[model samples]
Each structure stands twice: as C-alpha cells, then as structure tokens.
Target: MKKKLIQYSDGYLNRVPILQFILVTLLFPLWGAAASLNEILITQFKVVFELSDFATAFVQSAFYGGYFLIAIPAATVIKKTSYRVAIIIGLLLYIIGCYLFFPASNMATYGMFLVAIFGIAIGLSFLETSANTYATMLGPKESATRRINLSQLFNPIGNIVGIILGKYFVFTDGASLESQLAGMTPAEAEVFSQEMLQRTLVPYQFILIILLVVLLMFLFVKFPKTKPETSKNVKNKVNLGETLKYLSKNNPFKKGILAQFIYMALQTTVWSFTIRLALEINPNINERFASNFMIYSFVAFFVGRLIANVLMTKFKPTFVLTIYGIIGVAALTYTAFVPNMTAVYGAIFVSVLFGPCWPTIYGRTLETVDDKYRETAGAILVMAIIGGAVGPVVQGFFSDMFGSLQLSFIIPMLFFLYLAIYFLSENKNDSHVKEESKIA
Candidate 1:
C-alpha cells in the first residue's frame, strides 16, 4: 500500500506560511522608515520654527506618545478580532496621518504636524503589536526568536531608505535654513517657512503612496489564522486587570519590558542627535552632509542584524545579546568622553550593537508567556516604546543644561550598560531553569 500523506490546515506541514510571513515581515520596514524619518524632521523643525532643542524633541514625544496610548487598545483589538483586521486598521490610520501632513504644511502649523505624527504612530502601534506577535506564531516556538530577527532585518532597510529620502529631498544643501531665514525680510521669511514646510512634506507624500499600495496588498492577502484567532473559547476577552497581574509575575516578561523601554530610549536618542552631533563636531558640514553618518549608522544596523540572525542560531539569544550590549556600552562610553570625529563614528557603530537587542528581548519575553496572553503581552511590550518619546527629550534637556551635546551621550551609555547587565542576569536565570529541569 502507498504511504499516506499528512494534511496541514494552515500551510505546508503547518510550517511557516512563507508568503504570509513575507507580507507580515514587510510591515517592519514600513514603520522603520517612518521612525527614522523623524530624525530628519527634528533637524528641519528646529531650524524652521526657531525652536530650542527641548522644543524640537517634542516631535518624537508626539510620535511615540501615540504608541504608548494606543498599544493596549490595539492589543485588545487583536484579541477580539484578528491580526489582519488590526493591521488594516493600522494602515488606515497611517494613511490618514500621512494625509494630514498636507494640511499641516498648508497651515504652517507645528502643532498640526505633531497631531499628524501622533496619528501615524497610532497606526504603527497597531502594526507593531500585531505584526510582532503574528511573526512569532508563524513558526515553531523554538525558532521564534530567529524568525522575528529575520523579519526585523528589513527594518534597517527602511531606516536607510528614510535617511536617504531625507538627505536628498527633505534637507537642502546650502546655507542653513537658520542663516537663510536670518537674511530674509519678515514677509519673505514667512513665505520661505511655508515653502520649507511644504518641501518637508514631499517625503511623507511619497511614503503615503507606498503605504497605500501596502495597505491594498494587506487587504487582499489571506493570512493564516493563528492560535489567538483560531480559538473558540469565550474566555479570550482581554482583562487588563488580570492580564497585568499575570504578566507582573512573569519575571522575564517584566524585565523584558524594562529592557525594551531602555533600548528604545537609547535608539531614539542616538539617532535623533546623530546629525546634531555631526554638525557640532564637524562644523563645516551641512545637514545634508551630516546625514551621511546617519545613513552609515543605518547600514551598520542592517549588517549587525544580519550577523545577529546568524549568531542567534548558534548561541543563546541572551548570550549573544549580552555581548552586543557590552560592546554598545563600550562604544557609547567612548562617544561620551571623547568628543571628536572618531567618537562620532563610535556612536554610529553602536547602531550595529543595538540591532538585535529589541527583537531578542521581545522574543525572549514572550517565550515565558502563555499563548492565551500573547497578544496582550505583545501590546504591553510595544507600549514600552514610549521610551523613544522620553529618551530624546531627556538628552535634549541634558544638552541644554550643560551646554554640551557630547556630554549628553552619557545617558545612552548608561542605558546600554543596563541592557548588558539585564541580559547577563537573564542568562544566569535560564541556566538555573535548565539545571532544575534536568535534575527533575
């Protein structure tokens, strides 16, 4: 008799739905481009609005604040509905937010631009909450970390594209906008400000078109139903009180939340200040030239992610993460104490070290979580992204208080140090658990 074949419901052998996984992975870069573009906006807005460093930092504050506020609601949406539906909702919010940029530019209102950014972030929050959790569910639990890291590999591609867009389109190559505004008559300055604001909108307009195409793709694609969606139990409703209590007891998840928060803060603060630091260190370069360093940083980030993907397959994710974290702390320490062009390079190289920290923390955190609580756990993790909002502002404050941008590098250095230690401790805990299990 011929051997019988086993049938899988979701996909081949119930393995990863390759096409669906690709589509979901694409979401990483989309949000990444948006996030990195904010770095350019920070530089542009500071000059255009004649704002202080602290004021300019509000750009990130508004953007990530949206993530913090909407994360739980987004998780709830995923629990109640499906990841596809939540992603569609996210895309819609992203589209709406992109559209608002036009009106914001036309009105020449900074506040309106912030509102637009917040809307985009809300969309991003939903996408991140859903896409991240969904990616983990795409394969076996054992490979989840590697799988999420693979998806995140595309993120730096988006970051690179974003920086390139800003470098070429958003930033002007000439006398600084501040200098140009100083030379203009009052009426000319108002007209010029409007013109510059409109120019800044160009990249967003392009991104909007891309978002629309992706949205359509997402709308048409049939995603595999994962555990959360496949369940028929009525008890799946997300109870914030109970969920919080459960997650609170999970030591790894709690620590992961804290680590994610610090990682975001470090990432945002580092990128936001990259151009500023370059300009400060190399006073002759324009913003356009300064942006090249940011691009280099993004490239380093991409390379680091690729390397981490390989490394994680061979070593424990926590062990690899610990090493990366140590190197990041060392790099940033050099960056803080030594305010030279080489130090700036050190700051740029830190991006490579940072590449794996987020996904590693995220994947490891969720590993300890029950499948039933995964969506809520993922949402809370995304909410930790509020660190992005808070970090830059804190760095800006330090820069303003001390009248030294380089000294502000100390903040991220300390943050990196904490990550190194946190993961080191986690490694010890994992070993202990394994020993206990073996003994039993």
Candidate 2:
C-alpha cells in the first residue's frame, strides 16, 4: 500500500500541477510582508510612544505570540477539516487584522496595536500551518524540501518590499522620529504623533485590499486535494497526553524543536534590532538609511535560499545545516566582539546562515516523525516559534541593561552555538541514513 502511494506521488510530482502550485506560492509573500513590517513598527513605536527597549520588544511578543497561541488549534482544524478551509479562515482573520489597524491607529494605544498584530498573527498562524503542509504534499517526498524552498524564495521578496514600505510609509522620515520630535513643542508633538500613527494606516489598508482579493480567489479556485493518507478521513481527536508521550520518545524530533526555537529567536532578535545596531555604530544615520540594512539582510536571505537549494541537492540537509550553523557562529562572533561597521555588516551577513535554518529544520523533523503524527509534529514546531516572542525580549532586556545593542548580540551568538551542536549531533546519528539526509 505504501509502495503504491509512493508510485502515485511520483507521477503527481512529475507534473506538479503548475497552476495550483503557483496559486499556493502566491500566499507565501503576504504573511512574509506582514512579519517583516513588524521591525519598522518596533522602531517607530519605541520613539513615538516613549517606550523602553523591553516595552518595544512586546511588538514581537504580541506578533509571534499569536502564532504560538493558534498553531496547535490550527493543526487540529487542518486535520479535521481541509487545508482549503484552514486557508480561508486564515485569510479572513488577516483581513480583519489589517483593517483593524485603521481603528488601532485612531485609538493610538500601544495595546490596541498589539491586539491588531495579534489578530494578524492568528491569520498567519493558520495560513502557515496549512500552507507548509500543503506545499510539501504537492510533490514527491524526495523533492518536498526543494518544493518548499522554491515557494519560500518569495518570502524574502515580501520582506524586502515590507522594509521599503516601512522606510517610506511607516517611518517616513530620514532621521529618527525622536530626533524630529525634539524640535517640536508640546502642542506640535501631539499633532506630529497623531500624524505619524495615521501614516501606518496606508500600508495596512493596502494589505487589507490584497487579503480580500486573495481570499476571493482562493474561494473560487479549485485546489488539487492531496490529503495525507494518515490524516484523511481520520477522526479528529487531540490527545495531548498521547502527543506528549510520542514526542518524549522521539529524540530527533525533540532536538528539532529546540533548534527551531533557537533559530526563530535568533532570527527575530537580529532583524528586530538591526536598525538599532546600525545606529549605534553610526548615530548620524537616519531611520530610512538604517532600514536599508534590513533590505540587505532580506536580499542575503533571498540569495541564501537560492544557494541553499543548490547545496541541498548535493549534500545532506543536516550536513549543510551544520556548516551554516558554524558560519553563523563565526559571523555572530564578529557581531558580538567588534563594535564597528564591520560588526554591523557581520550582523547582516548572519541572515545567509539564518535563511535556510527554519525550512531545513522543518524538513528534517518531518522526516523523523511517523506519518500518523506529522500534522501534530508540524504544529509543535510552529508553536516553538514562541522563541521569536521570548528571544527578542531577552535581547532587549540585555540591551537595556548593558546599554549597547552590539553587546546584546551575544544572545543570538549563543543561539547559533546550540544549533551547531544540534545539527552536528544529528549528522553523527545520520551515519547509516545517507538517503534520509539527502531527502531531508
């Protein structure tokens, strides 16, 4: 029976239903743009609202927290219903969240913005949980990672666009908002703050329109349903105790979750503070100029995906992951010790290593788990994205305590060190499973 499924999947993968694949890939950039735009919000809100580093870090907390909160439930939904239903639900939530930004800006409260971000995150969580599984299912198991990487290549494109929009629309000025506000009187500052908050509405309003269009398209388009044999027609019952028992015995799965948590934390902290790191190195640099560093990171990320795709073809994903982890440690060493422009560029350079970590980890772990448990496995991994929420706050706390964003990079350095250890450990155990490594 399994052999028959494999033969069927090979035929399905050969042709790969081009139009359906393109439609699914189209959803990739939307959430990517939403997630990347958050860095701009962190910077803008910090100054406009007079927030501490720790307080500003809550922007990430609220954003990724939504993912942690929704991932497990979304997994159940996908397992119980269908991927298409999950995606539609996700899109609707995204639309509501994007439209809420208008009222959130009017309310002009940080908490309201957090609520809006949380709503958007709920949508993203749903989309990501369903979309990732769907993408992998679209092709043969051997080419699953390759297919996911091809689709994910668009993610950084969205990040670049988000950064550009943030540079022009959200932040809008060359200098820091604080610096500009310094010249304003109390009355003028109030007006300026309101106007700055209002500026956020434009991009989010545009996002709302885009989400609505995507939602309608998905509703109308007929997606090829390639439901997993394990999940299809199975009764949906989320037994936490059973899931926990299964995970506890699966060492590779456990390690993969830890690696994912660390990777997410590292990625979120690095991107969230890249601007601050740049400004620390050059205080005269404007917010718009500093944001260009983010564009560089995303560009590196895009390029890294392209390169990693090729590398994965020739080597084991675990082997390549270990090598990237080593490079990350070296780059982060420069970031932590050197406080010059060289260190800031080193920070940007780390994105190349960071780029493939998530997908690699996802692919690696998906291979480790039993077919019956894959959906739950994906959720647990996504839930581990809470690392993004927790990591930045820790880094932000360190930044505030040490009064140096450069020094705070030590947090991410430690994260990369753990990833190196995890990947190397996996590589050693993979000695007998060369075929598994290649596919992973």
Candidate 3:
C-alpha cells in the first residue's frame, strides 16, 4: 500500500489512499510551524528597524503581496514540473528567504525584511499549491475532503511547535537584544540585527540538511507517478474556457469555491485583527505576550485540524463545515462585540471550523472536475489563498478607517455566514455523502 502511494499515477493508488494521505501529510506540519513566524517577524522588524507598528504590519502585507503574485505562477510551475521537483524548488526558495535575512539585517532596511518575507511567502505558495492537490489525489472523489482533512493534521501540530520555537529562539524579546540594537549606530544596528536574525540560520540549515537526506531517500524511494485519467468524464485538455466552464456548470463546484473564497477572506481578517485586539487589552504588549497569542492561535489551529481529522472518519466534511461555520460566526461576532478574554476565546474556537475548510474545499473542487483537470483544479484551489493577502489588507484598511480593530472582523464573519448557508443547503440535498479518512 505504501509503495502504491509513492506511485499514485497508476490506478493502484486508489487501493491505498490512506497511505497516500500519510505520505503527503509529511508536508503539513511545516505549514503550522510557519504560523508564528509572521507575528514574530513583524514585531522584530519594528524594534530592530525602529519602524512604526503600522510599518511593521505593512511588512506582513508585503509578504502576502508576494504570496498573491507568486501563487498562480507557482501553480503553473507545478503543472509543468513534477510535484517532487516543485517541492524541491520550493525548499530552495525557502532557504533563500531565510538566508536573505542575513543581508537584510546587515542593511537594516525594513524594505529588505519585506523582500525576504516576500521570498518566503512565494516559496510557501509553491509548496501549498503542489502539496494540496497531491493530498486530494489520495482518496475517492466523494471522500476527498476527509482525506485532505486527515492529511492536514500535522500542519496545525507543526504550527503549535513552531510558535513555541519561534517565540523562544527566533524573535523573543529581550531588553538586552533591544538595548543592544538601540545603542548601535545604523551600521552597528545592521550588524546586530543581522547577527540576531542569523540565529534562524541554524534551524533553516537543519531543515535543509534534513531535506537533503530526504532527497537522497527519494532517489532510492519509489513513488508512483500516474498520469491523470485519459478517459475521464471531462476532456484531458485544460484551457481557460474549460476551467471557467467547468466551474460555472457545476453547482456544487461553484458553491464550493464561493465558500472557499469567503472562508479564506474571513480567516485572514480574524488573524490580522487578533493582533490589534491583543494590544488593545494591554497597551504595553511586549514580545512575550505576542508570542503567547501566537501560541494560542496555533493551539486553536491544532485543535481545529485534529478535530476535523477525527470527525472526517464519522461525519461528512460538509456537515463538519456547516456546523463549524455557524459556530465560527458566533465566535467572530462575540470576539468583535464582547469585551473580555473569555469572549475572545470564542474567536479561537472559530479556528476549529476554519482549519479544515481550506483542504475540504479543494477536495470538493477535485470532485467537481475530471481527473484530467486535477492540476488546474489544484491551481485554482490554491490561488484562493490570495484571500489571505487581500482580506487582511482590507481588514487593516478598515481598521485604519474605523479607528477600531474589533470592527474589522465583520468581514470574516460575513464570509462564514455565506459558507454556513452553502453547507446547510448541501447537507439538505444529501446528494454527496461519502466515506472519510479513518486515520484520525
């Protein structure tokens, strides 16, 4: 079964979807591990570069900006290149992003930091576009959501661990580090900041080393590379018209994408606003509290992903999505309007509903298209991450306009409301009930 998974091009892959899910899942934790990185990075940029809070936030905006621009192109690369090669390219890009920090710190330029984040986001975009589609391929069409959800378990778990490590080692606040940077001349600041960020090189180098070993293993490893189905219900050829036509014609597909777009939009808004909300409660929030929030957010992500993995085995992803969406609406509303940490924690629960939806939606897109169009479907699915860039920026804009961070979350709340409606409608039809991932 494991051997079959490594070679998914052949029909034999369907024989062991779980193993396929498992193997691709190896990439999921890296997703979570990267979560806290944004918050830590933004904070660090402000202190070392002596930039305003808004400027530091814009650095994050730049990363998402790069993510938006790079996603479709990366997807195109994946379609043309093999998944294995694409994964390697993504890792190389990630390494370059990390390495750039050395030079960026040396320059002590906020712009350089943004450039590095941009590089990292681009790499992540590539990784996601390729890996998500690969994960969906690991199961039956009807059960694809469950399979993808199971595959995403490690992403959140990785996120939790990453938050802790990033907090402790990457950008944890220190009067010493802060004072050291302050005392340095611009050139000295550059040197000091570079020195501090250079510490991240150790982790990045370790990852590179591990991946090198893994690459050698891949050389020895035999994974299947099956061609998409020739006689699929849809044509083998993919063009703009066909992609658009397919999406327009399929009700479930159209509904799925709508929900996906909005869901992503909402998720981005929540996280973006969470930072302000945290600061509002305590004006003097240091690196320590921010790290805690990162950890808390990751915990929510972990619980959410883990829950989806388990429930996918027993309940439909559609059902799970609906319940979570409604609950998410409640959570977001309370987080925005309610005034206490207890109420704010409700927002955290929203992560549970959210964590599983991205993969679930993409899995649905797979069902909407013929196997021949899997690559395109994957591209569109991942392209939806542009919502991360767009939604957060919009939230930030509204926060600036409204002079209140809490109100900006309304955007995500509304998006989830639409998703909730779609889920309810689908569940009522009972037309697409399917098997789920059982490894949970």
Between prediction 2 and prediction 3, which has the larger lDDT?
A: 2
Tens digits of lDDT, candidate 2, 1-440:
12222224221343366667887888889988998899989888888899988889999999999999999899888778777889999999998889889899999999999999999999999998888777877767777777777888888888888888888888765667778899999999989999999988777877877888889888998876565454344553436667768888999898888889998999999999998788788888878889999999999999999888889889877789899989999998899889688888999999887777888888778778765576778888888889999999999999999988899999999999899988888887787576777889
Best-fitting candidate, measured by lDDT? Answer: 1
Model 2: lDDT equals 0.85
Residue pairs with backbone overlap in model 3:
6-223, 6-224, 7-223, 7-224, 9-226, 28-155, 32-159, 33-158, 33-159, 266-412
- Report the lDDT tens digits of candidate 1 across residue range 357-417: 8888898888888767788899999999999999999999999988988889999998999
Report, for every candidate in turn, its global Cα lDDT versus the true structure. 0.87, 0.85, 0.65
Is 1 or 3 the stronger prediction by lDDT? Answer: 1
Where in model 3 is the C-alpha error above 4 Å? 1-12, 17-21, 46-60, 139-143, 173-216, 231-235, 239-241, 248-251, 273-276, 431-440
Q: lDDT per residue, candidate 3, 220-280, as tens digits?
A: 5445444464445444657656766776687776666667767767776666556446656
Which window of ten consecutive residues has the lowest lDDT sum in model 3? 3-12
TM-score of 3: 0.82
Native-to-model Cα distance after best TM-score fit, residue 308 in candidate 1, in Å: 1.0
Indicate the worst ten consecutive residues by lDDT in candidate 2. Answer: 1-10
Candidate 1 ranges beyond 4 A from true positions: 1-13, 229-238
Provide the lDDT at 260 for model 1: 95
TM-score against native, each model: 0.94, 0.93, 0.82
